[model samples]
Every structure is written in C-alpha cells, then in structure tokens.
Target: MRTLTVFALMAVVLGGSGRAAEVVVPADMSCRTEGFGYADTNRHDSSKLSVRASSNGNKSWIKFDQLGDYDLSKLRAATLTVFLHEGKSGSQQCDVSAVNDDVTENIKWVDHPNQENPAEEIYALTWNNAPGNLTSDMGLLDAAKTTYIDTITFTDGVEGQGFEVEVLDILLADTDGIVQFVLHNSPNLLNFATHDNPTEAKQPYLTLRFAPEGADHPVPEDGAEVDTTLAQLAWTNPEPNTPGEPIYCDVYLGADPNRLLMDKVEVGPDVSGVAINTDNFPNFGLLANKVTYYWVVDCYDTDKGLIKGEFWSFYTNDNLPPEVDAGADQVVWLGMGEDPNQVTTTLSGVTSDDGLPGPYTVLWTQEVNDAPAVVIVNADQDVATVTFSERGVYEFTLTADDGDKQTSDTVQVIVGDSPCDASHMSTGEPYHPADANQDCIVDLADFVLLLAEDWLACTDTLTQCGMLLPM
Candidate 1:
C-alpha cells in the first residue's frame, strides 16, 4: 500500500496528466506487399490486409501516427485490435514485428524491399509466449532478431473475428509518434479486414491507457486556516476535457503531513465535492485544534484503476467560540386562570463548536423583568421551553460553552392577556353572565356561588327582582 501511494504521487508529479485516448488506423496508413516477384503491384487501395505463402509469401504493414504527444512513459497498456475477415487454411500462424523500414502505404510491389532480395526467414509460433518474444522463432527470420515482436495464430473456420495485441513497447519506441509494423504468415494465407473495409466498425484501432490526472482547483486553498471543522473538500479532475467514462475519486485525510496515517473516503465518479467533519471522524477521535491536516485525492478510470494525484494541506483554526443560532421570537397568549406551564413556548437554538473537544453546556436564562411571576425554563437542553407566569414581554438568552469560549443568542417572548381575564370585571366592561366569579367561563364553581345567594330577594331599588325570579 505504501508503494502504491508513492507511485500514485509520482504519477501526478510526472506525465500522467492526460485522458485515455484511441487512434484508429487510417486507410492511407495500411497496405499489403506481394512477394511473387510482382514488385510493381500497388495494394494500397485493397479492402483487406493479407499475408500468404502461396505466391512467394505476401506481407502486410500498418502504421499509426500522432501518438508521441501522450505521456507514454507512464502508459498502463496499449492494445492493437485487428478484425479477421477470413482465412485460407486451418489454423495459420503469422509473424508480427516492429521493423526499422521507411515503407508507407504508397509503396508498390516493385518498390517493396524484399522483392529481389532473399525471402525473409520465418519462425514457428509458441504458446504462452511473453510479450516482445524476440527469442521465439517466428519462421520469418533466419536468426532471432530484436524486431520480432509477437506471433498470432488464426483459426481457419472463424471469420469476422477480432484480435488484440499488446504493443506498448513498440509504441513507446517510436519517438516521432509514428509506429510502423510488418506482418507475414508463417506458412499459409490469412485475410484480415483493413481500415477500408465496408463495415466501418471492423477497422483496426489502437487504445492507450494512462493514469487519470491529478486533482486541481482545491477548495479552501492549500496551507490556509479554516474557521470551521466541517470543511467542504472539493477538487477538479485534471482531464475533464478528455472523452471517456466517469472517473472515481478516493479522498485521503490525516493529521500527519506525510499522510501515512490517514483515513480513506470513497466518493462517486460524478461527485467532485464532499463535506468532512474533522471533529467527528468515526472511531478515530476528534481532530485537534490548531493542527495542520493533509489530504489528497486519487482518481481512477472506472475500468483501468488508480490514477494518483497530489497532496494538499490546511490548518484548523485556533480556539474559537461556538456558533449559536437562536430560533425566531415567539408570541403566545395566556388564558384566564391558566396554569403557567400550559402557556409555555419553546426557545430553539443550534450550536456548533469548531473542535468540540469536551462536553459542552447549553443554558437558557431569562433577564430580569417587572412581571410579578417566575419564568420556568428547561435549562439543560439546547431547545428549552419557557413558561411565563405574568403577561408581559420577556427576553431569554441561550448560551453554549465549549470549555474554551462561550457564545449566546437572544429570543423575545411576548405573553398577552386573554379576553376572559377576571381583572376585566372591575373595569366595568361587558362580561359573560355565566362568569359569576368573572374568572373565565361558567362552571361548577360559578353554580356554587349562585346557590349561596339563593332566595336573597332583591329588596334594593338597584336590584331587578322580577328578572331573577324563576327565569
């Protein structure tokens, strides 16, 4: 794992900066050369690439260019795919080599180099051969040569088949980005589709894979101080312009500058940002305040695997007060003769400390007021309920203490008088007749008061006895 991380870092610092790409073999870059002493015959416009032994051994060549600009030094792999249209014999062997020749698609049979010279010796094909098998006798050369690259065996009955060859070294060896190769059958004839084939999809092509580019444009800027522990980590894929499948990102974060002791967080191929709470890493303990933290993002091609990126660092802010958010002020009405507890309002507040290292305290306090009643508060919780015993405006403050510093916010509570207040009776205002005691409404207590005054005839001129009788 350590070695993998180092390699990934080097890739980011080196040439692994471009996206994966594919280059198709163009029609003008492919041609066939017949060896029947017909040196002047031009097969550049043929629809197929063929190699046969019947007519003095025919050979084919395909060249690919514009590959030098890519960072082939860090290339993961290079694949060359050719479509096989048909074969003349049963299981024919072919020799493929990276020859040092100045041949092009315009070269005619008479211009072919081997037309008058002795036929190129061929070698036998071997199974389970390592890549760049120069020692294997490909039957096309008199002695083993470094140019002999690979041997491909073709099945006679199968047609419209595709074969892939790993030609990474060959592509890297070409400094001009132009790669040329020659193919000849070991003994029999074999036909393969060329770039000019009617079926466009059957044309030969090359695919090169490299590590995904490093992360760019990070959030919060490197080597800066952040006020909050809940940092939003973000970065950009260096190869966003490269056309291919989505790339996956793995984020590594740690307090160590070397990033050896860190935690890994896997994100989506589509997501470029994630919020990480440094103070709340599961089972790893809270991140220390005033400590510098290091992080890096490693991107991967969903199909090709890890493409390492660079490392960035940032420092957590020094001791800071907790942030407090007191909920909106509340307005409530007190019913006549209602219990103070029944007329309660909740004072909601939210608090967050940059590095909540120890247990914090949340207290709700009521300021001094002129009302002749006590204010009861559920002081222990962040969201506390306050019961006002008198009708008036009350201000409550919520404070959060995180050992180092304290922060507070205020909320206003307005308690209004109810319409059924007993005090309104003395004001000579109209009131419900059933409210004998003028507390709120008619009830068993009012009936008891009326019974106490039963049979007390209205002898005074101010009393209306007729209305009180029986009715």
Candidate 2:
C-alpha cells in the first residue's frame, strides 16, 4: 500500500495571496450524513455540512470531478479549504480520509455510520488549544504509508473559522479524474458551508499549485496544412526533462474544442517529441483525409513545475478521390411468369466524398462481358435501369468524378432464358428459383410437389367459393 504523510495543517484565514498557476475548484457534489432526524435520508441539497461523533454521529463528504484539468504529476501543493459556517472547537480534532469510490450526492448515514463502507483513512488533521502555530506530522494509509507535515491549533472556540489542510499526497495518487474526501469529528460538532451554501464564496473548494511553465514551438506550426499521412508531432521544449527531472506531456486533440479528451503521452526526460497515431487516439480514430485538427500540450516537470501549452491547429490535405460502392453483385432472371425475356433491373450505386475541392458526378455504364449488348436508361445517374436483349452474364460499372479524381465500381448481372436456365444445376449447390422440390432441377416432379403442398391455400376473403374475379 502506498501511503502519504500529511505534512501540515493550519487554521489560517480563508482569503490569502494567490499564486499565478493556482486553481481554486469548488466541489461539484457534496452530501452530509444525518444520524438524528433521518439516518437513511440523503442530505445532498443541504446548504450546511455537519460533522460530529457520539451516538447520533453526522459526517460529510465532498467530491470534485474532472481532476484531469490539473496536472497531478507536477502538483506542488493541494490545500483543502472549507468555510466553517457554525462551529466552535477548542481541542476537537477533525479527520479527512480518501474514499474508494466516488460517492454520489444521495449518500445516507445509514449506509455507513463511521465512514462509507469502503472508505480508506488516507489522512487526518488534529488541532489543540495552543495559540500561534504547531507542527504535527501524521501518517495516512493508502497504497503506501503516510507522513505528517504541519500542525493545526484552535485557540478559542468561535464560529466562522476557516480551515486549510494540505492534501498533496491524496490528490497525487488519484488515478481516476475524481477527488473525494470524507470529514469526521468524533467528539466535537462542527458545521461547514457546502456547495449548496447561499453564499458561493463560502463554499468548500480545493486550491492547487503546479510546477513552473515551459515554452513549446510545435512542428508543422499551428494552422499549417499538411498531408493526411503525417503521423509524428515534434516540439521544441525550452526546458527539456533531464534524467533526474522527468517530465510528462499530455496531448489533447479533437475537432471540438470543448471535448478534447485525447490520450496523454508520458515522455521520458530529455525527449521533446512524441508520435501522434491511432495508438494514442483510441476514441478519436485516425486522422481524416481533410480535416482541421486541434491539439493542446501540457507538460509536467518533476523539478521546475508544470505548465499547460496553448491550442494548436492544422488542416490536412484534401486531394483524395471519392469512394463508391456499386451495390451488391446482382443475380436477376429474364422475366417473371408470362414474360420470359423482358428483364429490367434497377442499379443503385453509392458514393462518398470529403467535400474538398467541390461536388462530384456519377455515371453508370455497361461492360461488354457475355451479352448481345444491353440497353441502359439514365446512364448518367447512380440509379439506372438496364434491359437485357439476350440471355448471358453482364457487368455494369458505376464511376464517380470529383473534377480532379475519379473512382469506379462494377456489379455483375446474370440473365437467363428461364429461372432454371440462369441458376439451376445438377450439383444441388447454387440457388435455383424454379427448383420447388429443391432437387436442383425444374421437372414435372417439382410441379406435382408444389400442387400437393399448397393445393387450396388461398387467402381471398371475397372468393369463398374458390372463383377468381378478373382485375
């Protein structure tokens, strides 16, 4: 188990001097456990978060989503700040621990009184009645052990006291893009403002500080047009990661600027280039032929600090030809029943384009394979009709033109004198339409079987007497 030591805890004023890269993210979800009025009821919408012990214990949990926005690898300090709405504590100690799962807002005290059943005691903070400052180091359990940093002292019991605790180790070890903490005080009753607090500024939040920044000049440049096959991305890192000081670069790429959840690439120290291919973009797929791609880079230096890069965009070339599918290879017979040689089949072709240079054109032409030549109506359209003059095999080609490029596909059409002539065989393999008995032959035996199976199976309501009316 990896453990993180809580180095310090201070009961400082809420407002303080801010850092350049400091980010204050409020808890998006929060809930408190009620043990007195309703132990099983969820207080997610409650404006106050209460923590107490005794028999009617009350605990609170706060959760923050999208932790990926901050670089945890280069996190220098993470302070959990909460506004004490109503509470007076002289020597009471409150502890905060990490939970295994992201607890929903509908959490109840009856679910787990002590903490969430799966909650892990990652870290805790203790404060005494002594004035000034105190240095208290405590260990918290996780995958590893814990260590303490500073001490927190609560002199006179008073309302509206803001508490700040360092929780760097907890945030650093989080794998999922979520940060959740549970607050518990066994002896003292304390109430804090929650995310639903009337005053938004008094709500609980986390302030994060990351490493320094770095200058990056991306290859191919931003907004440059490049080939579709370009697979590598290079950058000039003014401060490269050395052997002792490792750095990671997270690359986010997508067409939509809002949903750029691309993969992150961890580059070794001294390396300044990374490959941009399908292996990195599992959800985004491959680079399209003609598209304007947007990408951002965030680097985390183990020594100097972490810095996020600006958004860069480049357009891919669009000279590729259109794709086409000439439907499935068709199998048609001469004619149904009465007409044995007047077969007219419609040919449907599908085409796809990138809309690059402009619009495209489509045409369907007959290929001379085995035939006495066929007549095609509307040969310049994707859907055309072809009439067969003789019984043989034929092919129709559908070609698409985009002014600069042309692509074509062909479909085969087989025509015969009768249903048996075009498809029947002695091998009993290929489908034969006239083979009613399924013997692969169109003989008198098939007709006898058909009559015996469907002798008087007609669904005509008006002809109950079995007399047919002329239409």
Candidate 3:
C-alpha cells in the first residue's frame, strides 16, 4: 500500500554564542547507511533512544537544532532512524553533519553508499563526526516510515524549558515516508570528560563546567534531611510561625551536613518547623528517639540558580519519648458478693493528659472469688481510699485514658474469713456426739424428733434430720 525511501541530508542545529546557546547539527553533518541505522525495533540499539516516522516518503530535511537553547559541549551524541517500504530509489544517498563552537574545523559530514535496491536504515551522530574520531556509528536510517531514536549529548548545552532540536537533508523514495525523531536524556557514561577539538574548530558550540570549579555534579543521599527530592526544593507557607514570617522553618536530621549532603537544615522562606507526617516537610522524616540519620539543606534565588550549600555528612536525631505528665484521673468502687448492701467507692487524680492536673474520671472493675467489683471516679476528688465490708477478699485498682491509648494499675486487700468451718466437726459415729443438729451433746441414739408421716416416707427420715419446730 505505502512506499518508503532513504533521506539525503542531515544537519546539526546550534544555538547562539552564550554559555547556553544550542546547535542543530553535530561535528560532521553526513548520513552513512552502509552498516549503520536503528536496531531491530527501528530505534537505536547502543544509544538510549527510540523514534518513529511517517511511511514511504523522501526529499525532506531533519533538523537537530530548531530553537537551540544549549551549547554543543554539553551534548554527548545524536542519531536518526529510517524505514523503507515500497519505494522508487534503487539505492541510498544522504549526508549527516555536526558542528561545534570551534571556529576552525567546525562542521563534519558523511554520506551513505549506493544500493542496487532500497532497504530500511538507522543512523547515529557519534565519533564519526571528527576527522580522526571513530566512524563506526553515524547516520544509518531514513526518518520517514521508520522509527528513529537519537541520543544527543552537548558539552554545556542541554534542554530546559522552551528548548528545540533540528534535523535536515532528507531524501526518501517512499511516497508515504514520514520522519519521527526523539531525544534521550540518558547519560554518556564513557564520555563524561570528552571535550571538543579546540584546534579543529575555531568556535566551540557549548561549554558547561561542573561544581566546585573542578568537582562533578554532586551526588544525592537518601538519609539526608530535605524538604523534597524534587529538582527544585522550594518552600512556601501562607501563615507565619513564632518569628511572624508566613513560612519560617528548618530541616533537621543529622549532624553537620555539608560534607555529606548540604546545608544545616535551617532553610528559609518557609521551612523552619513542621508537624509530623507533613509532605516535603524538609523532604525527610525526623528519626524518633534520637535515632541519628543523614541530612542537608539548600537555598534558591529567583535569578541565581540553586545555591547548593556544602554537603555535610553525619549522624544525629531529635526525637522525644511520650510525655507522662498526665492531667486528671478518677475512680469509683461498687461492692460485690452475698453482701446485703451495695456501696460504691471513687477517687480522682490529675487530668490524664490535658497538661493540667484536674477533675478526672477513673473507671475500673475486676473479678475476685466469683464476684464482680465495679468502680468509677469523677473530676471532683484528688484521692480515694478503698474499703470493703464483705467476708470476701478485694483488690483496689485504677484506670485512666490518654489521647490515643489508656492506662491502669492495681492494689490488693484481704476481706472475709472461712465459710468452710463446718468441715472440722465431722464425727466417727452417726449416733453419739453427732447429734446431727450439734447441740454440743448427743441425744437421739435413734429416737429424737418426729415429723408428719406425710413428709417422712423419703430416705427413711432420720430422727434428727426430720425434726421440725411447730410453726
């Protein structure tokens, strides 16, 4: 149905001459299709990128720099992918180019070999851009109908907001050939220190130096106390704190922080203090119980970039245990067991947790020898003396409530004596001192009391057991 063709030209777009200018083309602007192009999936295999394009088309330009915002030195590499379908071109013919700020040998270019027939291709902007630099990888594929992935790394040039890339010099035979280009933000591991050929190019395209005038980008630590992991750690507070400013707070975590991360946790504009579990609250949770952890801090200006403070590394924590200064508490007691009378006892302590000792209620109850004892205390009293009158034993206990949890304690007391004294009176004979009724003497040696015959038939009614006083 659709057709495809290889492109003709490729260009590197560069920005103006600032520490932030951009370049559209690379070292040598040229296309090489002999043994280069995207991988099996129509994108780059080695570089970190992937792209897609329209089908069956040609005679167009691929720009690497459109609204160039960065310099060339910041860039690491570039690439282009080509897709081939039904087409008219019997072979491939195209050029890829790159340019640096160097005024001398500023531009680099390459072309693809002619083919008896047409096929899909993938391309890259790599070492080949330089005269003596390796040409193993360069432009390899057509953008139309092909997914092209390009990884471009500039010396000091990179993307921020409102940045653009340009690609041109395209020639495709596919009537429907389309070009899709994408940029990757992956790092160039092996080329972190790669620099442009100062002698070859009079005007270098870009230039960006690392921090500390010599050190590389600072490493981020997880244990560090921060307001947030966001690229920009800005603080905002609509209402002020003790100082009166709307947002006055500090981020505290570890000891001196510069050598490990940055700042003293005393950030500004808004971050000075925070409650528990608040988001970006200094970007880190405070370790409980003085559990030391890492921490850092930084500042930002509307005009000046991030003012990264010296990275400090240490172990320090600021956690306190639960406050035990419970306010008011109370207790009331309810008597238990066969006692014909019921009584309630109560006592009140300082307010459980109101920060002020006051009228408080204490509620508690427990089981003693099969009897349930109940108690309740109100805010009117400060102390209660527990007392019991029954023959049973008793235990005095107290309970109170905290904001999230409750607490209690206990004290023991002894009550009533043996209800089992009858067991010691058992005698050997059923007739003698066992007067059965225990009158301190034996009387019914088999004859004693009498009962109505109507009720005496059961168990052959023993004399002493059946005697009933005349009612």
Candidate 4:
C-alpha cells in the first residue's frame, strides 16, 4: 500500500456522521458472543436483535434493541475506520444503536451503524452510525496512495460532554490472510484506547493511540516478516480520545495495496509448522502463490488501547505439499489399529502444490470383487472413510486431482471376526435340536441321530428322549 495524507481523512469522517447534534437513541449493552465473517442481510427474528456476521458477510453494521437505558447526553460523536483484508471480496460496514434491555419490546440488542444501509446498497463498506456507535470510511485509497492520518470531532449536541473519535472498527478479509489497522488521537490526551480489541485467529492485528501527532503514523521500516506494501487500513474512536466511556474499535479493508496487482493471497498462521490436518488453514481457504510483500497492522490490547506496529514482510514456500509417504499407504484408522473390527478407515495423502486446500476424491473398494465405489469427488477435505461393517478387508483408493491432472493412492485393512457368535444358541452347546449335528433340522437325518444318541425319560430338555410321539 502507498501512503495516505491526513487532510483526506477528516473530510471522510465529517461527511458521514451527518449533523453534529443528531438525535441519538437509548442504547446500553453488555457483552454478547457473536459469530463473525459473512453476516446476513435479513432482519433479526426477535426484531433482528441477535446480530453476528452472517453469510451476509464482513459487511459491518450494529443491530440491537433500544429503549430508555441510553441518555443521548452520555452519547458522544466519533470517527471510525472500517478495514478489510485487501483482495478479499466481502462487506465491512459500521453498526451503531441503542437498545432497551426491556423484555418483549426489545432485548439483548444494542448498537448503531456508522452509515445507513440502502436497499440496492452495493457497499464496499456497509457504513452505519447511530446514537451510540460511530463509523467512517477513509474511503478507498489506491495501492499507490500514501499513508493517511487525521484528527476528529463533532460540531453540535452539547458543547462539551467530552466527545471523542479515534479509530474504531478494524477488520480485513483476505484471500490473503493478513490485515493492517491504525488509529490516531489528539496530542493533549496522553492516553487513548485502541479502536477495536484483538480478534480471534492468527491474522496479524495491531492498534495504537499516538500522543498529539505521535510519530507520523509509523510506516513499515522495511525488511520485516510481513509486507507493508500489500495491507489495507481503518479504525474507530469516540469524538475525541475521551476517558472511561466507550471507545469500541471497528476496522475494515478495501481493494488497495502498493502497486495494486493483488487479486487474492493466502494468509493464516506462519503455517510453516502445522502438520496434523494434512492441509493448512483448510477452513479459511487462504493460501497463495509463493511470493514476498510487506504489511502493517494494529490491535486493541488489554493494557494499550490501540498500539500500532510497523510494516514487515515474510516469504512463503506456498508450493510445497505436506510431508507424507507418497509411495506408501494412504489410509489411517481411528480406534482400531493393525486390524480394525467395525472401526473406520480413512484415505489420506492426496494434497496439492500451492496448498490451497484440495482437489481430492474419496473412493472406496470392499475388496470383494466388486468395482471401487466413488464416495466424494473434488472434496476439499483430504481423508475419506469406509465406516464400520462386516468383517473383511476394505480397500480405499484416494485420487487427487489438481486442475489438469490426477494422482492416486490406496490403503487397505482387514476386519476382525464378528463381535457375536452366529453358530451357538442360548444353551452352552452348539445350536441343534435333540440330535446335535443332524444337519440343523429335526427331519429324517435328525430322527436317525436321535435314535442313536439317547433314550427313555420324558423331559422338556431335548437331550432326554421320551416315549416317542410319532413325528
């Protein structure tokens, strides 16, 4: 990413907040666990109250119930930057609101979006701001754009309720796994809160609040573990950097990086060490071609509100596959070891070059003379299984297809004897009538055997032969 000038930032923030003394809503909220990434556009069932990132995606916006718990005087105006992982396609919108904790009418809802959402609103940033939450878009900057810095404030309402705005929401979605976020504050306020708190996952995040123009927004000093050149930026804050109010962080990302050639990039943990799952970061689907670039980011820390970090770069060998026996066996069992008795057998060892996830197929064979079975085709998951069944050898063939070609491997196993014996009946002896081994029936064969075997007493036990009732 290039650099951004400070002047361009303030205008974007002011333009979005609307009138300084805008009529806000009653909003107060406690902590609520939420599902993130891809949110839904549909309203909440309980008045669209329970809001989390749905398939609707990273599009940012806050939704909650509102009533009297909020005093507009207690609410201050602020500016927030919504950042997303560059090269990633999704929504990053601002959310703000005031929800009354009241039951029936509204409950468990609280928040305000930076900007209102339009129906046809195809947003690069789903900006929403309400009585409580504040949102801003530094707007979109080209990869060649320079670093941007800014100061914030609201014009009307009450002259000095001590309102503030720093960086707020900081989120980046990437086909590439990294995101960079930055926050700015007034020089008078020595202390400041980070716009957003740390998020889950290993994606890089850093947050900082500079003292009165603190450090020209530290640029990536070059030669680091991440590429500063490929990262996007955003933030959130109260009208000014105030003390003990709400300085929730909100970040975002857009399509802009240095030189602007990035389509998508694979990103996750260092990923150089994970071995158990076969494919690295399989769930996120973020991995890319081998390359090097720089990145910068910020995060909300327990101690430091938002501490900013410098840009760094790291190189990746994205083309290598997991280290497994390609020529050897391709199956692994669950509980059953060398021999499995009604356990599971999974096909393994089919992977790819760039390590994107997979282009693997799960095939099965019973080893009974029948042709192999096609279980799953083009599955991103590596292993395929043949669950518990009758005792015998089960074979699985894993075929890996990478676009233009296919690679295959097989694994087989033997099932042990049945858990229950079929030949014996409830009695301690083998299953039979009065004449054991008489070919299993009381026909002529058994009659002859009965005559040879026993004699006289009449008893319920078949073993005792009584005065014969003519068969």
| lDDT (C-alpha) at residue 21 in model 4 | 30
Q: Rate the local accuracy (lDDT) of all candidates.
A: 0.60, 0.63, 0.29, 0.29
- Model 4 Cα lDDT, one tens digit per residue, 229-316: 3233221222323444332231211123331332322222111111212142132124233445433333333334553323334443
Model 1 residue 183 lDDT? 67
lDDT of 1: 0.60
TM-score, structure 4 vs. true: 0.19
Every model: Cα RMSD to truth: 30.0, 23.8, 29.3, 24.0
lDDT of 1 at 31: 61
Q: Roughly what TM-score does model 1 have, to 2 decimal places?
A: 0.37
Which whole-number lDDT from 0 to 100 does residue 443 have in model 3? 55
Which residue ranges in model 2 land beyond 4 Å of their true spot? 1-20, 101-153, 215-471
Cα deviation at 219, candidate 2, in Å, is 32
Q: Evaluate model 3: give its lDDT.
A: 0.29
Candidate 1 lDDT tens digits, 1-471: 000000001012234333333334342355665543443454543467777655555666665655666767766567666666664457667777764423322222122233333243211111111112222232353223227667776555355666667777776666666666566655766777776677666666666766435666678677877754545788886554456678778777877744467877778776787777644334223556677778778887755467777677887766678888778876676753357434767788887776755677888887777644555467767887766666777777788898867999988776666544424522446668877887767888898887766657566554375554443
Error of 3 at 36 (Å): 80
Predicted candidate 3 versus true structure: per-residue lDDT over 1-471, tens digit per residue: 111222323333433211212223332222211123322112112211111121111111222222233322233332233222112222222222222122112121212223112233223333222222222322323232233322332233211201122232221211222222212112221111101212222111121221221111222343343322223322222232234533323443343343344223444564533332323333344333333344333434343334333333333222211222222332222244354344333433332444222333454444365433544343223355444434334554455543333455554433322222111222222333445544345555313442333444655334445675455
2 versus 3: better TM-score goes to: 2
What TM-score number comes out for model 2? Answer: 0.34
Q: What's the residue-level lDDT of 307 in candidate 3?
A: 38
**What is the clash count for each candidate, in the order shown?**
12, 25, 156, 114
